[model samples]
Target: MKINQYIRQAQYKKGFASIILIGVIVLVALGGYFTLKAKQKSSPEQTSTTATDQKVYTISDTNKSTTNQLIAESKIIESLKTNWQSIQALIPFRPGHPGTVAWLSPYSVQFIGKNNLLVGFEDGYNPGVAVLNFNNDQFKILETFKNQAVFTFSDWQSLINKYGNSSYPVSTYTVSLLRNKQIVSFQDLINVPENIFLKNY
Candidate 1:
């Protein structure tokens, strides 16, 4: 009878152990599933591509990709232009204090993927693009392009033709292209892609 009792106790312990082991496995699997789900929800594609107060574009060359880049801004046309691609990304502002941007002026800010750009203005206030040039690798703000915001349909049409957008967001924006304060126009601009000059530059 004692032998039987001992056998029964051993069987009970084995069964209990089996139950505990299976429970542990289930708990671990559930934990892993939740952890993986959390990670999947936070990916780079879900991240904002633009810089603070700027539009961010991921431009790729044949062999390389650039990020946070600041390029020269101009009113010229480009055949193969690299813009925000979507005017929805632009943040227009009226001119601010010169210190609004770290390296440039305080009129408008544009994101050149890897670099933050400051756009300057001629009137020291207003939202407009400067046809800029580059001297010794530095951006030089040149001519300013302005539409009357004329409060008229014809005025709207003119801006739409120039900026290539009839529905661009209108606001007081700021950025300053850092270069010779006296320089203006795309003529002196350097590092500009030829395609930008050809079509929608």
Candidate 2:
């Protein structure tokens, strides 16, 4: 009789322990679910709610990355402004399309890589593009494009079609030009398509 009583108590204890184990597992799962929900609620939205959100995020969601890239590029251009004269002097050849050189100026200069620069030359009648490689204060012209047609854009639509809708290079002065023309919400100028150099002249 005593043996039977002890067996029943052992069985009860085992069932009770199993119930406690199940309860603990269920509690842990609920805690984890609530924690995940809390984190999601606290997180910021990936897309802006409206245009009034912020200046940086005012553009379309697809343009956020483009805007960021342009901002960073603007900073680089500003820093390189101090060395404009030295950079311009590195151009070995003058572009002459119709007649005399007239004027040679590097209007839009931006770094395409760590040591490579894509320079846009405004030579009066013949605007051109030049890719220069610089190292240790020395600049070597890799290639040049002296086609006036490539740099001409009638309006914003023509500009987009030419440059694949990417953000264009802009200067402090040109910012107002873009605004006055109402070309785009942001200031920009037609940048030379980088792929032009990939092909043979």
Candidate 3:
């Protein structure tokens, strides 16, 4: 009888221990699930938000990336201002078609379009080209010209002639590219049907 009682008590204790082990496992699982949910709730959304929210203010692999980007943009803007001022002052070349806006031309010597002053030479601006907003006046200059990149008006006109009306006697693409302190032939305004160079006007 004593042996049976001892056996019964041993079985009970084993059952109780098994129950406690299962309870501990279940509690740990539940706790882990809640912890994961809390972590997800604390995470920030990287996308699926408005542009203002999703816009990256700065991008850099190292520290001071924002500062470097701002400095780069500022330098480009200053170059643009200087070029605009030069065009107005006629530093090296005189305005080819002054007093009357040309709007387009194809001579290698460089000619201001009849529409330059008519539109104040503000053809249109892209990411590389910046239009100043200080005095509500539009201005343009090559942002990457100093890197030896070129934007030729003749090339632009050729494309326009090939893809566009192909008329020999028509308006010239009123565009210019600036690089390395001089006008470049990398990008200029051209009148393509798709407006590859001449867009945003």
1 versus 3: better TM-score goes to? 1
**In model 2, which runs have C-alpha deviations exceeding 4 angstroms?**
1-67, 95-104, 107-117, 132-141, 147-201
lDDT of 1: 0.35
Sorting all predicted structures by TM-score, with the top scorer first, yields 2, 1, 3
TM-score, one value per model: 0.28, 0.35, 0.25
Best by TM-score: 2
Span of ten consecutive residues with least summed lDDT in model 1: 192-201
What is the lDDT for 118 in model 1?
Answer: 22
Number of the top lDDT candidate: 2
Model 1, position 157: C-alpha lDDT score: 44
Error at 123, model 1, angstroms? 46
Q: Note the Cα lDDT for every prediction shown.
A: 0.35, 0.50, 0.35
Predicted candidate 1 versus true structure: per-residue lDDT over 38-119, tens digit per residue: 8656423123212311332434563122222232233221201333222212333333546443112233332221212223
How close to the true structure is residue 145 of candidate 3, measured as C-alpha lDDT? 18
lDDT of 2: 0.50
